[model samples]
Every structure is written in C-alpha cells, then in structure tokens.
Target chain A: MRLQFILSEIGIGLRRNLSMTISVILVTFVSLTFVGAAILTQGQIQKFKGEWYDKVEITVYLCPRDSTVPSCADGEATQEHINQIEQVLESPEVSPEIREVMFESKDDAWVAFERNFSDRWWFTEMSVDDMNASFRIKLTDPEEYQVINEVLTGRAGVEEVRDQREIYEPLFDVLTKATLVASGLAGVMLLAAVLLITTTIRLSALSRRRETGIMRLVGASTLFIQLPFMLEGAIAATVGALLACVALWGGVHYLVEGWLGQNMDWIPYVTTGDVLMVAPWLIIVAILLAAISSIVTLSRYTKV
Target chain B: MIRFDNVTKVYARGARPALNDLTVEIERGEFVFLVGASGSGKSTFLRLTLREEKATSGRVLVAGQDLTALSNWKVPAMRRKIGAVFQDFRLLPNKTVFENVAFALQVIGKPKHHILTTVPETLDMVGLAGKEKRRPHELSGGEQQRVAIARAFVNRPDILLCDEPTGNLDPTTSLGIMRLLDRINRTGTTVVMATHDDEIVDQMRKRVIELQTGELVRDQSRGVYGSSR
Candidate 1:
C-alpha cells in the first residue's frame, strides 16, 4: 500500500512539473552523451596506438655522393663505413634491441621512389644516383628510438636518424586534445544538470507543502515523505541517460561503423558494445545526481 | 495522557514567551478544551504536545514519553500515537476523501487489506460513507473538516489534538464537528482542543483551561467559556 501511494505521488509530481522535468531530461542526456563520446575517443586513440606503433621503424639514412651534411664531407659512403655500420647492427650487445634489419641500396630506393611518384612530372628529374641508401631497423620496443638514434647518428656515413612514430605524433595529439575538450564540456553540462534537478525538486516540494505538512501531522517519517520527490528526479534522469545511450548507439552505428568503417577499414572504431558498457554507468551517475540534489533540497524543504 | 510541567515557549530572542511556566495534565479518555485569545498560548500548547516546538525551560510529555528527550529520528514514531486536526482542513487537494483518509494509514505502513477495510469504516463513522469519491473542494466546509477528522482518527491514536478545528465552519457546521469530536472522545481517545468559540465551550460543558498572555489563568470542571477569568 505504501509503495502504491509513493508511486502515485511520483506520477502526480512529474505531471505537475512537466516542463522542468523535460529540461532535466534533456540536460542529463546531452551531458552524458559528451561523457560517452569522451570515453569512446580515448578507446579509439588506444586502438590506433596498438595497431600502428608496432610497425614503426627507425631509419638510418646514409649520405650520397652529392650530400652537403658535414658528416658526409668526404662524399658518398665508402664500403668500409658501410661494413662498420653493418657490424654494429649485428653486434651481440644490440641484437636484443633490433627485431629485424633491412639494407636498401640507392638502386632499390630509386625503384620505390619511381613506383610512388612515376605519375608526377618531378619523376623525370630524379635518377638512381640521386637516391640515398638507408638501413631500416625495427626495434623490439618502438619507444626505444632515442637509444638507436644516438647509436647511429653522427657516424661517418650517416646523414640522419628518424623514427616513424614522429610522423604519427601530430595525429595522436589532435585526438587526445579532442578527448579533453569533450570531457570539459561534459563537466560543465553535468553541473547544469545538477542545479536544474535541485530546482525541480525544490519547486515540486514547495508546491506540495500542504500535503507534506498533513503527512507530517499524521506521523509520516521524513523518508516516507521525501521518497516520492527523490524518485521523481531519479526517474527523469534515468530517462535522460537512456536517451543518451540511444544517441551514442546511433552515432556509433551510422557515423562510425556504417560510414567511417566502410571508408577507413584499417582504423578500429568503437562499437555499440562500447556504448552498452557505458550505459549502466550513466544510469548510476544519474541516480547519484538525483540522490545528492534531493538530499540537500529535502533537508531544507521537507524537514519532517 | 498528556502532561505539561511548567512548560515555557519563547519564539524570538527577546519577545515574551508563548507559553509561560504553564503546568497542566489530562488523563486517559478525558475531553479538555484550551480557550484563550489569539496570543494566549493555546496553539502553542497544542504545538508543544506535538513536539513541533521545544519548550523554553520545562518539559512536555505525551503518552508518557518525554518529548524533550526524544531524538529527531524517533519523533515520527512518537507522533503515530497521536492524531492532529487543524483549522484549515489540510487535505491533499488532488486526492478523494477516501484517499485522504487512507493516506494516514498508508503512511504508517499499514497493509493493503487493512487500509481498504479501515478507511471506509472510518469514513462511515465521520458521516462521509457515500462521499468517499468527492474531492475536498467538492465537499462542504463541514464535510472537509470531517475528512480531516476521519484521517486523524483512523489510526486509532491514543490522543487527539485539535487547534481550532471548527474555526472556519458556520455555527451549525461547527456544532456538527463538535458532536463528532464528542463522539470520538467517548471512544476513550484523550482529546485536547484549543478554540475561541464561546458557545461550543459552554454547550459542551467539558473541562476548560483558559490562558491569558501566555499564562494559565483558570482550569474548571464542566466549565463555561466566560466563567474563567
């Protein structure tokens, strides 16, 4: 009987404050959508790192006959300098650090360059002798690029040492910054949600002061009187969270999986399963927000 | 049973106490009236019994429990043993007469079958048997007061406290309310009512306690409203 009464009271309160309740729902939905997007963006960044980082190689470029680098002042690399560099790579001390090594002569480099730029007019000006031979070394740990670069750079025949990770750093930085922006917006929206929920509960409680006063006189406990109001906020917030989940699911399905996945098949995108994983947390946060706001407001308004 | 041991209630920092060193007691099944002018501490006396306000210096006891010593969490349990009615007939505007009466039982965690059975019977006792579906605004002023009374008494409380329950009713309606109260009192529920109505006080011929400027000035058995100084 008490449960039935409380449910009825919640229904009455929501109906009476329809506009305010809808505002709470929309605010919660928008804020939690940002939160969900932030989580998925972080997951996408991690997925990219997992897939790309392992293939990253450190390239040690040797000087050519026409090179202007100070280390190449003697002109094109001698056979002895090439033999010394190869010995260092095969040394027992560096063997564990090097996963695989490949030597690309200028002839081999010219063939790759031609294959890539053959359609461009610039291809007519390039020749085999103008290409620089390089040693490409794959490291057991790509993060150990600094150690390999220090070992190979400033050598007699070397021009420069470059890690492939530098090529991808700017892309990752943009993604990380995007995640931060999403979280910042989510934080501000959540604050608005809390305040709106507090006001909604306060107004509902004020409008029903007479009924609550009567409830108090008849010996209703403070919890009994406040439960319906708290549940009102909780119900609205839960609906908002569910709407957020639906929005996230739709975005991931249509935008990420349907469109982007088809065009960029190499990149791993966050799936609907990820949105489902975040759904429960959004509901929990909504309930907690409503609980906290109700507790603070009810203590002042429904002081039984 | 209720006892006021030299209870004094001061509302503000420097204002006069609402109830000044007042001492009174009413035993089981007795009907008592508290009559006074607007600032005579009549409502304050009822509020003290309800523990709505703490006494400034002395203690107020209801059903043998020291209200001053009762913790905040235990106030609700303490209140369940008492019924209260107000001048405004504080009913939920959206609920029917039956729902208004059943609310009291529902709040106290009564079972569904128990509420369904007891609410109609209590409504019948208040002469609102066939008017269960009517809203408070749809009913007459007297009928609204009856719904309030039915809500108060439905829990079978040990004591009933009223603060000018008939103040808003006409003389005829007020007479009907008083007779209903009288009938309730005959059921062995201790009733303490505060009122400014002179005719009902004299007509009922019950024990009357009158206050003047926060001090108890008179207590008489089978008293008339004007007989007290």
Candidate 2:
C-alpha cells in the first residue's frame, strides 16, 4: 500500500512539473554525452600512441661524394668509413637500445630515390652519386633516442643523425590536447545538470507542501514524506542517462565505424566497445546527481 | 487519557505564553470541550499534546508517555495513538474521498488488504460510504469534514483531537458531526474538541475546560459554553 501511494504521488509530481522535468532530462542527457565522449577520446589517444611509437625509427644520413659537410671533408664515404660506423652500432654498449639496424649503400639509396621521384622533372636531374647512404635504426625504446644520437652524430662520413619522433610528436601532442578540451567541456555541462535537477526538486516540494503538512499531521516519518519527490528526480535523471547511452552507441556505430573507419582503416579508432565501457559511469553520475539534489532540496523544504 | 501539568508554552522570549503555568487531567473515555476566545492557547494545547510544540517548562503527557521528553524520532509513534482533525479539513485536493481516508493508513505503512477493508468501513461510519469516489472539491463543507474525521478515526486511536472540526460547517451540519464524535467517544476514544460554537457546547452538556488569556478559568462537568460569565 505504501508503494502504491508513493508511486501515485510520483506520477502526480511528474505530471505537475512536466516542463521542468523535461528540461532536467535534456540537461542531464547533454552532460553525460560529453562525459562519454571524453572517455572514448582518451581511449583513442592510447591506441594511436601504442601503434605509432613501436613503428617510428631514427635515420642517420651519411654524406654523399659531392657533400660539403665538415664531417665528410675527407671526400665520399668509403667502405672503411661505413664498416667503422657499423661496428659501433653493433657494440655491446649500444646494441641493446638498437632493436634492428638496416644499412643502405650509395647505390641502394639511389635506387629508392629514383623509384619515389621518377615522375618529377627534378628526378631526371638527380643521379646515383648525388644520393647519401644511411643507417636506419629502429629502437627498442623510442624515448631513448638520445642514446643513439650521441653515439652516431659527427662521426666521420656522417652528415646528420635525426630521430623521426620530431615528425610524429606534434601529432600526439594535438591528440592529447583534444582529450583535455573534451574533459573540460564535460565538467561544465555536469555542473549545469546538477543545478537544474536541484531546482526541479525544490519546485515540486513547494507545490506539494499542503500534502506534506497533512502527511506530517497523520504521523508520517520524514522519509515517508520525502520519498515521492526523490523518486521523481531519480526517474527523470535515469531516463536522461539511458538516453545518453543509446546516443553514444549510435554515434560509435555510424560515425566511427561507418564514416571514419571506412575511410582510414589503419588509424586505431575507438569502437562501440569503448562506449560500452563508459556507459556505466554515465549512469552512475546521473544517479549521484539525482541523489544529491534530492538530499539538498528535501532537507529544507519537506522537513517534518 | 491526556494530562497537562503546569504546562507553559512561550512561543517567543518575553512574549505572553500561549499556555501559562496550568495543570489539567482528562480521564479516559471522557468527552471534553476546550473552549476559549482567540489567542487563549487552545491550539497550543493541542499542539503540545501532539508534540508539534514542546512545553517551555512543565510536562504534557498523553497515553502515559511524557511528551516533553519524547525523542524526535519517536514522535510519529506517539502521534499514531492520537488522531488529529483540523478546521480546514486538510484533505489532499486531487484525491478521491476513499483515497484521502486511505492515506492515513498508507502513511503509517499499512498493507493493501487492511486498507481496503478499514477505509470503507470508517467512511461508512462517518456517513460518507456512497460518496467515496468524489474529490474534496465536489463535496460540501460538512462532507469534507466528515472525510477528515473518518481519516482520523480509521486507525481506532485511543484519543481524538479536533481543532474546530465544525468551524466552517452550517449549524445543522455541525450537529451531525458532533453526533459522530459522540458515537466514537462511546467506543472509549477520548475526545478533546476546541471550538467557539456555543450552541453545540450548550446542547451537548459534556465536560468543559475554558481558557482565558492562556490560563484555566473554569473546568466544569456537565458544563455549558458560558457557565460563569
């Protein structure tokens, strides 16, 4: 009987404040959607970081026969100069940091150059002697690039020792910044949701003050008097949270899988699985929003 | 049974007490009238008995429990033993007559089967059986008060406190309500009604406890509305 009465009371309250209830649901839906987006963005950043970091390599470009660099002033890199660089790269002190090393002779370098730029007019102006032979080293740990750079730079017949991270670090930095922006937006929207839920509950309590007074006079406990109002807030917020989950699922299905995934299959993207991981937290946040607002408003307005 | 021992209720410091230092004992099964002019502390007396307001100094006891010392959480249990009616009827405007009377049982956590049997029975006793489906707005003043009275008496409380239950009703309607209260009193539920209806008080000839400026001016058996002056 108590449940029946409380249910009917909840129905009455929701119907009485239909417009405000809708606003509360809409606000909570928007906020929780942002929260899901932030979580998935972070997941995407992690996937890209893991895949690219393992594939990046450092390249040491040796001077050509016509080179003017001081390290190559002795003339074109001879077989002796190339053999000495190879010895240092395979030494026990440096070999562990170097996962794999592939050497390209002047002839090998010329062949790759011709293959890549054959269609350009400048390709006809280039010859095998103008190309620089190089050592390409993939590291076990990309962060230890300084270890290989110190050993190889300014060595005889070497023109420059460069790490490829310089090319990709900026891309990673932009992704990290995007994640931060999404999280910041989620915080602001969550605060708005909290305020809206609190106002809706306070108004509901005020409009039903006469009923509460009568309930109090009939020996109802404080919890009994406040239950219907609390349930009203919970129902609206939970619906918003559930709607957010459905929207996120649809977003990942259509936007990520259908649009982005089809166009760029190699870039590691966040999937619906990532959204599923985030769904529970959005619901928990919605519940906490309702619980806190109910506590704050009912304590003062419906106190027995 | 209700007992007020030197109960002094001061709503604000240095203000005239709503109920001055006064003592009164009401026996079980007795029907009493709490008669006074405006501001004579009749409402405060009922409020203290209900623990709505604690006595500033003295003790107000009901059903052998000292209400002044009752803990806040236990006040609800204390109140269940005493049903309360009001001048305004205090019915939920949106509920039907049956639901309004059933509400009292529901708030106290009664089961569905129990409410179904008791609510209609109580409504029938108060002469509102056939009008169960009507809302408060559809009922006359006396019928609304009957619904309120039925809600109070549904639980078979040991005592019933009515604060001008008939204040807004016509003379004939007020008489009918009084008959119902009399019947409930015959079942051994003590009745304390605060009213200014001189005709009802004079015709009933029950015990009267009159107040003047928050002090007891007269306590007479088989009393009239103006026995002294």
Q: Could you estimate the TM-score for every candidate?
A: 0.92, 0.88
Give candidate 1 regions above 4 Å deviation: A82-131, A138-144, B227-229
- DockQ, every prediction: 0.73, 0.67
Best-performing candidate as measured by lDDT = 1
Q: Give the TM-score of candidate 2.
A: 0.88
- What is the C-alpha lDDT profile of model 1 across A160-235, one tens digit per residue? 8999899889988998999999999999999999999999999999999988887888899989999999999999
For candidate 2, what is the lDDT?
Answer: 0.90
Q: Model 1 compared with the native: what TM-score?
A: 0.92
Tens digit of per-residue lDDT, candidate 2, span A145-247: 9998998888998988989878877877877788788778879988888889899999999899988887888889888889899889999998999899999
